[model samples]
Target: MDVAGIARIATEMTDFSTKEAVGIAVLKKAIDINAAGALALIEVIPDNSQSAPNLPLNLGRNINTIA
Candidate 1:
């Protein structure tokens, strides 16, 4: 192939590589943001386990299904 054709192909390949890199970087950022948000949400959930300590320990241990 001529020099011009080779140059064009190289330029196209470079552009494709750059676009792919940018896409991957953006996806990583989005995933990081989502993970941070999920952790924040999880942290805010009230700890109900300690709040009901007054109930009997065996209250929920067994189920009576003979009724």
Candidate 2:
């Protein structure tokens, strides 16, 4: 899903009495978005970048850790 869609879902999932659901949803969505963005960045890297292959995996790990 796109960032806007994720944001909308996060907003809709929120309840005034309990913030945990909303917080978790938002955090997960943010991590997903970040991972996607990191992959995109890796794709756009110049062919000379030798470490490009590991970028997405590292980013995924970092984002997962956050979630």
Q: Cα deviation of 36 in candidate 2 (Å)? A: 0.7
User: How does each model score on lDDT?
Assistant: 0.91, 0.75
Per-residue lDDT for 1-67 in model 1, tens only? 9999999999999999999999999999999999999999999986656757888766666899999
- Clashing residue pairs in all predictions, respectively, total 0, 0
Minimal lDDT window, size 10, model 2:
56-65
Clashing pairs in 2: none
Residue 36 lDDT (model 1): 100
lDDT string for model 2 (7-67, tens) is 8877777654258867889999999999999999998986633656756544533345564
Q: For model 1, name the residue pairs that clash.
A: none
Q: What is the lDDT of residue 17 in candidate 1?
A: 100
